[model samples]
Target: MDGDYVIGGVFSIHYYMHTVKHNYTTMPEPLSCTGSIDSRELRFSRTMVFAIEQINNSTELLPGIKLGYEIYDSCASVSVAVHVAFQLSGGLDPVFNTGDKCSQSGMVMAVVGESGSTPSISMLRVIGPFNIPQVSHFATCACLSDKQHYPSFFRTIPSDQFQADALAKLVKHFGWTWIGAVQSDSDYGNNGMASFLHAARKEGICVEYSESFSRTHPRSRIQRVADVIRRSTAKVVVAFTSTGDMRILLEELSRKPSPPRQWIGSESWVTDPDMLRFSFLAGAIGFGIEKSVIPGLRDFLLDLSPSKVADSPLLTMFWEEAFNCRLVKSFQ
Candidate 1:
């Protein structure tokens, strides 16, 4: 999406990256990321494109100026995210000495992503120094609210502190004085769970257990968490996990018969439609962002074709998965 001004988008469209084994003998090959595509994150990227198109078409907004975008997949890696931030900030481009007095600037006027808090933090370290404004849609780590550190950072989602307080209040209201806690082992989950624990203590709540895990952790680690969940005497479980980690844990817990317990979720995974497949998650409660109906947005999203997405490998993959067919390129 090219225009007079470009907005850079950083999204974790892929849930994981291939583990690279380096022999330390030669330069490692380019990083290869292999993982299941995250359809929700894909939608967010398309929505960025859609909104840019709408703004470009509008006669009143920005008047004659055209808005463009450059979207990149972070592949859920902090290193990759930092690399992308540098790219967006023009830090990776080679400088050529042209006989001009004017200074060079990056192609992107601003950035609009890095969906998770840890990745956002990594990106901020790269772009924040350059004074490039970055806004996140889902990164809710409470530490990001420090203006003294992330001066050019902003977000559409509320900080985790508020959500933690709400979750603690919800538990106290339900008389669940004792509960088990699980969190993703990252900035988002770790910081969020810390806030929730602090709030819970103030409300006279006690946690029976607190465990953390990442999606990339070994199966045995995830199983251990599930085993703890199964053995805990607390009837209510508070989970501050991302969708990926939650899915892994649910898969482990569903392997055999297990006692049913009330589940409390964070906004990161609470409203995910994919979690519905786990029957044990019935009656789970959590907070979510308010939903809004955007006029004509549904039609815009549906207006797609093989030809339209031919240039984008990501879109082509998504199309093939959606239609259950392989797309071949014709030389003619």
Candidate 2:
């Protein structure tokens, strides 16, 4: 904003509304990797602070009750602005603490957009591993109770820890002898892969190779993962990347004369209507995936609202964004 306005913090139970008046810089950093996303030339601020602020503006532009807002200056990177905000938060408390950055625990909802580094479902602890929004939900899994707090921190997604156990059971059931491991470079990826490895190894399952991809770098994400599958001693490859990244890898693998010995996709690997527009992940597999679950998860997610009509900016952004993309194709 302009000069001095006291906003120690911000608090909105379900709706996130903020009037951000700050300078945002417009500079593009483009990178490529084999991961799900091909290449995005995002303004540096969009990743963290800028992204939150944009969502805030979008919330303003698009009014909603369940919106998470991030405020920032127009001329700064998300990291720089966040560091400044964190230091700033020490002296004063905000009116709202979206998920992280403030200790006032009540209930916070984390929107899983880009399962970039790890599957959003994999790592949920916002405070521990990554100190990101994911942990806010995880914190609820601990001894603390959100019932006691006003703006409690809660995660709606199923946990990867739980997913890992289910997947490991599936692996054992199928008698899969070996698996290759691929992950995005983030807490979700790291933790999920670790869980996968632990589960498989406990069952005497062999991990062929473990590889990680950078979210910001897409150039080699696909190729390296496919290459690992092609050349590795293992058969199935466990992935922590998003469906977008999975689509790319699967499409590229389909292109190869040879293919992975067998494919084991995370639950994140699912079909969306817009995913097919790019025509990447077709022919990757038929409708044969072992299902995983979190007990009471579906009910829990559905229970987020007393009715289906409860407005959510984050959900609107998600489906709107998804609707804008191409759905996953069955074949070329």
Best by TM-score: 1
Per-residue error (Å), model 2, residue 141 = 11
**Candidate 2 global TM-score:** 0.45
lDDT of 1: 0.89
Stretches of candidate 2 exceeding 4 Å from the true structure? 1-152, 251-257, 271-332
TM-score of each: 0.95, 0.45
Q: Predicted candidate 1: what Cα RMSD to the true structure?
A: 1.7
Best model per lDDT: 1
Q: Residue-wise lDDT of candidate 2 within 1-332, one digit each (tens)?
A: 21122221111111112234445675433211111111121111123333344545564654552344332221112233233334333333345556657553322323322222222223222222323343221211212223342132334345567667666777788787677778756555567767878887888888768887743456566677677678877756667655444555656666773543555555545333334543433433322234466444445334433123125433333334435743332332
Give the range of the ten consecutive residues with the poorest summed lDDT in model 1.
91-100
State the lDDT of candidate 1 residue by residue for 36-86, as single tens digits. 788899999989988999999999999889987889999888888987887
Per-residue lDDT for 60 in model 2? Answer: 64
The 10-residue segment of model 2 with minimum total lDDT is: 8-17
